[model samples]
Target chain A: MLDTIRRLVDEQGRLAVAAEAIGDNADLYATGLTSFAAVQLMLALEETFDVEFPDRMLNRRSFSSIASIAGCLHELKEAA
Target chain B: MCQACDSFLDRLFAKGVLHETGVDGLYGRGQAFEAVIEGMDRLITRLAEGDHAEVIRFPPGMNRALFEKSGYMKNFPQLAGTVHSFAGSEKDHLALLDNIHNGGDWTGGQGATDIVLTPAACYPLYPIVARRGQLAPEGGLFDIQSYCFRHEPSKDPARMQMFRMREFVRIGLPEQAASFRESWLERARGFAETLELPHHIDVANDPFFGRAGRMMASSQREQALKFELLVPIESTENPTACQSFNYHQDHFGELWGIKTASGETAHTACVGFGMERLALALFKHHGIDTNGWPTSVRAALSL
Candidate 1:
């Protein structure tokens, strides 16, 4: 799941650095993932993972890093 | 707000500083109120003279096509107010009048016009500058003032449906835009001191509309894209946002094809002064009568 998340970040996240350059817990925003790009990343994650992020998970923290996004996806899968 | 703060609106109306227009957030300003607003506008103009900014004044409405391209409805559909007109024939007009006379929905016949109310003072400037092609080496600086509209209506006099905004817009590189907004943060504090208005600056976000908007607004705050200079007018705890400095990173430029001298997408920034709110703040903090305002404040405004 972490690898897949990293792949998605590399594909969708418009970060200044490659997803492989940072750890799973690295701050995506601090690495220049813009707000608009985050929206694109969220949409891409939903499509790729077949899970919809609820309003409760729609926040900066939810997309702060690959690890956080994986954690949010795990929670969503559990709820499903 | 508290009960005491509610009385401030009543006192303004009673003192004839603002005339109630049978609407919650709409009011007519009396002569003294207009004078104060004019004085504040003059002070803003005087402070911005050093920048040699190009002054552009726009009407209350803007081209609907440009507005749609700006993507305002995507984020703030709730606050948009578009103009609609009765574009039907004479027979349709008669039917509309009959419906109105019979207490029916006459507005169903009204179609959307090509114009929408200007949401902010600088919304109209970008396309005009974009049409002019590339900016000068130093980039574009504009002084704009306009009557802007929002749909929110309330008893809080500071939150008006229609109000005037005086803004200085900067279009250039990211650093240039950031520095322009940064300078205003300092200049605004100085203006507040000269006017004797107690104020504070804080990271702020627009009231973005929905669930998706919540994330956008959070990201905006996290990135420090917007800031507000707040003053206590209706509520001490909440305080009114009398001025805002926003750094819109390439948003307007990308939408309008605005380009810097080096050909990169231009970043934009603006510092907007809520003209009516500032006047109300002065009235609330000082007194309703401008004649009785503090000596230093009066001198600063030349009132």
Candidate 2:
């Protein structure tokens, strides 16, 4: 999971650095994760896990970070 | 099908309504309006549950500075609606009142700020995500429904000054972005088909930049990168776009400083459903008679 995030950060450049500075609890929306980017991340997660993300999980909290995403994924996996 | 839509449309044409403004432009009233609202409510509720799409509501307008920084002004100056500020002295204010009383153009004297109404629902989401820490070696998703505004005025029911957009956004790696878009293309098409709407998946080209926008419209027919789910709502000859599948290719992630868990530029994609347009399409296809519709369709729409 960390590897995936690391890769995302590296590719994302300064945003990755900003995210690190903000720490996990900081609001991603406030930091800079525009709505468009959130959608992009959602697509990536869906592909990575080979699972379809339920629509209900599409919210600010769900996309908060790797931890929140992983939690959502775990829930999805368990449901499956 | 909402009976209100039928009556509204019928009355609109019967009266030969040429052009109207505001929400009234679309004639949202009577039986047609009620049917449309009810139908949309039911459809959205079902989709929210079935797709697990979380819903977020944004203010009608967005921050002006953010919009300018996002390159919206450069991309769509014509479609842009700017907010204004008032910085006038008492004399200026009194003069403005006098001008209004005299039927003079008072709008010019307000000294407004250039804030814009949000053209798309997802524009605000990126800055929000950027505030959060980097993705934890994984990406994220968001489902947002927003009241979007665009200044382009069209008489067609498919186009409106204000509209509802349901968007599913994915932010992550390039491969992930491609895959997600691919999957959604299929899913969106399926959704439309379920409603008995005939749709074809085709590539979409960005609306041409600058003077080229006009040429792009013509060229789009040949180089179909922009994919749209077309259904007949206002006109049978020209199908209206009910849904669109877009692969933005990290344009936003780069702009907003969003990164994937791997610390790389994230690719982005979205599936947008124009909820009001869909409701309109459904009404056109199924007619406004709730009683005459099929049981299964009625059950699905909860009419």
Candidate 3:
């Protein structure tokens, strides 16, 4: 899941550096994943993972870092 | 006309559209500037005559209590400018004078007032209309304008600390407000075409504050509540938003207790034009000479 998430972040995050180059706990915002690009990444995530991010989970903290996103996806997977 | 772009301010200075008053963001608008600005205003007035919006002109400063109630501070505390003054004893006045004479900071003794510089043209109207209870069955529309102040000091002529905002607001049901925005969106495009400025409308959000604000901005964009008509002013790569269309889905209605004729919270939308910024764009694009502008634009603006 992490690898797949990392791949999506790499493809859709529009970050300056590769996703694999960043640590799993590195802050995405700090790496220049802008608010504008976040939506694209989000849409790509929903498409790739087949999960809709609820409005409550659509916040900076939920996407703060790869670990946080993985945690959120794990919760969603469990809920499903 | 100045050939190089860096001398844009110099050109404005020569044309008397912008006058430097030794302040970074505060400057005087001369005849040329006012001519185009007021010309555009009159054009809008004629165009908006059909709407029959109640015209309300507010003082630049608003009541501090209302300002707080609007929660502008929560989202944009950094940009808000609060008026403060020195109210003190004779000795304190003497001390203030001494501090100023000695080049000290006398502003520290100043205190906040009931007034706050108007940040947006629509803030005061919501509560005022809300206090009147339920709206008419036909809903309400307002034509409001004010000199708004934001504490943004910059070298860019497009970004001013104080500027005028001409806005038309719609207060009513969801479908009505949405339609109002939709029509105005088209009208805005028409106005841009008439003015002969190269522009585009894009989904946008307010420059919210902090991480929470980041989320708010995203959600706002995701919901497509805000749109800005961006015109290339200072740079072609990054254009300035000369006009904005926003639909606040019951944010102000809930905060101000405004309701529609049906007794539900009113949905609100507004279209605002950054008067000076548009003029700046014209000057940048059409050169300082208004007469030299394309005849179609001149005829459209009736300049």
The lDDT for every candidate, in the order shown, is: 0.91, 0.66, 0.88
**Docking quality level of the chain pair in candidate 2:** incorrect
lDDT of 3 at B260: 88
By TM-score, is 1 or 3 better? 1
Per-residue CA lDDT of model 1 for A1-80, tens digit only, reads 98888888888886778888889888898897877678878888999999988887878889999889999999999989
Candidate 1 per-residue lDDT, tens place, B55-165, comes to: 899999999999998888988999899999989999999999999999999999899999999999999899899999998889999999999999999989999999999
Candidate 3 residue lDDT tens string, A36-80 = 467667778788899988867877677878899999899998999
* Cα misplacement distance, residue B58 of candidate 1 (Å): 0.7
Task: Report RMSD (Å) for each prediction in the order shown.
Answer: 3.1, 15.6, 10.0
- The residue-by-residue lDDT of candidate 2 on A31-77, one tens digit each, is 66654456556666666778776656655566666667667878988
Error of 3 at B270 (Å): 0.6
Write model 3 residue lDDT over B1-303, tens digit each, in one string: 436754777777776778998877799999878888988999899879899999999999999999998989877888999999888889999999999999999998999988999999999899899888899988999999999998888888999999999999999999889999999999999899888899999999897775446677876887699999999998999999999999998778878988888789899999999998999999889988888989987877778
Poorly placed runs, candidate 1 (over 4 Å): A1-33, A43-56, B1-6
List the candidates ranked by lDDT, beginning with the highest: 1, 3, 2
